[model samples]
Target: MPFYRFDHAPDPVEKAGFSPEEVPRAITAIGADLVAGMGLKEMGVHFHRKAQLIFTLRGIVRCEADDGVWIVPPRCAVWIPGGMPHSAALSGAVEIYCLFVDPDAAPALPAGCCTVAVSPLLEQLLRHAAHMPVMYDEDGPDGRIATVLLDQLARAPVEQLNFPMPQDPRLRRIAAALMADPADRATIEAWGKRMAAAPRTLTRALTRETGLSFGRWRQQLHILIALQRLDQGAAVQSVAQELGYESAGAFVTMFRKALGKPPARYLAERRRQDGNGAD
Candidate 1:
């Protein structure tokens, strides 16, 4: 697909006798308040001419890029490097924020796509920037805010929300099948038998390509799927059963071990961070 650049913010300086080019728009932002089933359900695979940061304060967005899937939960954002092909899926009620930055604006920021932790400070800055004029005074307060935002972005911590997909056709097929049917409780040997490969060969290929063992890789996918389902209001028991867990308690235990908290508390904390609820 052809690369596209979007200008969501328009410079009004030309009307004031000042050339629009005189202002340096290193960064620009767009915000939206979308209700359930009201906005884009998916952005088909495409590439952008500018680096992009997408986050939501009260909903979830699933992004696919860099041969991996990323979950953009509350208090987190997904960074897509310039010219990278990616797509996004959005649903439910969402208060989404997006930043389009000149690729050269921050050399220190991550060069690859990642899920980055969004600090409260950065979140507030994003909200502020989203409201500023497109061509605010470059030597004034707005300029300073843009500079600080870039600094904050460079310092943002990367989160472990990425579900890497292997490049091998066989492994890719397996990944797709698992995602399509996450409830499948098949063993390596069974999966291998279907692929016409030995269990050991399948395991080795997965580890070599994704830097994760077969079990770990599948678990990562499960965690990503579980987070999205839970965020969408699926009951814990329902989510566990959907994922083929024998019991809700088993699912909770696995979730706690993977994410450092149980499912309810985890989602609650995210809601609290988004100012939707109290601790």
Candidate 2:
């Protein structure tokens, strides 16, 4: 099934007796055991009411919020802000390792949810953390591991997969419509007529809400849809046609411009990177 909306799950922290503040050190201590216990199909959510860093050791996990959705593949992690309602859906089976960081450790990270590329050292550290017990003594190996994990987390590279929120109701309405059918080729005037707003008003809303013109926003939406499809193993040509592009060449051009690489190249690089690591 297509994942289009954010679904709330029951709070697992309360049941597990784990607080967000302690999740980082806790996970660093019990990293391996947690991965072995929670199979990929088992969905989990931590209301990390404190800014937290979650690492994905294997497989892909999809995160959805009111603003956008993120596909966190192997060797990539997500930084989720405290109190942001987000849920994850794992793809197939996964090792699913994670580390939660205390807010004080990384104050500069985004308060909202975003994905980051994990380094090989960080991946190894998190995998090692899975074996330790939660709340382990700070003086023990787990405590030392936790300290290194925090250092690595601070240096992880942030990927550009963010979709900012559209605050204007008028622009939001247009965004929702575009998301519903990414292939829509409606002109600004046509969309304005459908929304019962003047074309100028719609233009202003697009610029204000998303910092992108209608053309740019549409392109971004198309690229996002393409990424989702590619992750599912959709053929490039088929995906292009499905997205209303004239040809695969046209789609590749747009994707390269948006992501700085062609789809096949991007996939190959990610696959190669995954093969070399804990993923």
Candidate 3:
């Protein structure tokens, strides 16, 4: 089904206890969904009234928003401000929880879309909040729970996981090819030959539009893609090879330079912080 319009998408939140005056704002995580690959129904962009925080429980989920394409792995989520058009892409099986908030009541969210790191406290809180009703009491346990959750969300650290896409058609060509095959090792000159624009024009457009050199932009792309592959339980060596690295050592160097740690160590540290690993 082609649901390009905002009205096409179903409303899952209002059905609960949500209303105009009872509780001006609320949070819910009960209706989580799991999927394998790009499901067409939710693939297209959808617009809704309330703000959203899409968290990944397992595997990786890729999404395109107003700012750019975000690489959402486990332990992280994308904050979509209310009334924005966004679309998602899937590569494999992924588990997810979507948290919808009222901007008026919860004004702590970023004014624009961005990726946020999920701390252990926030992770468990969202999991627990999923069971409560939509319009839980405002002065009881549920209310207190909601208040704490909101505070945590506002304090959650935002991550630099979004890969901004270039708007120029020329750069788009190169960008699309790289995304389709991250292993593509062709030079800009080589790619420009097939594109309508000249190599120099494409290079300049990339730098001007994205404020990043051609090489730097591709490296950023690789890292975002790397995060996705790594989240799928892929071995570091296997991912390096698949991404066209000359050697595992070289790939690790790049990963460390960009993310401040090697793949295994970084993930392990994240797990430890999330209290999923041994203390």
Weakest ten-residue segment in model 2 by summed lDDT:
1-10
Tens digits of per-residue lDDT, candidate 3, 20-118, equal 223355765443454665553347887667787888766667888874788786678999888898998655566666677876768767988988999
Worst 10 residues of 3 by lDDT: 1-10
For candidate 1, what is the TM-score?
0.85
lDDT-wise, the better of 2 and 3 is 3
1 or 2: which has the higher TM-score? 1
TM-score of each: 0.85, 0.75, 0.85
**Separate clash counts for every candidate:** 0, 8, 0
Whole-model Cα lDDT of every candidate shown, in order: 0.81, 0.66, 0.74
Greater-TM-score candidate between 2 and 3: 3
The reply for model 2, stretches above 4 Å from the true place, is 1-47, 54-75, 85-98
lDDT of 2 at 71: 59
lDDT of candidate 3 at residue 129, scale 0 to 100: 68
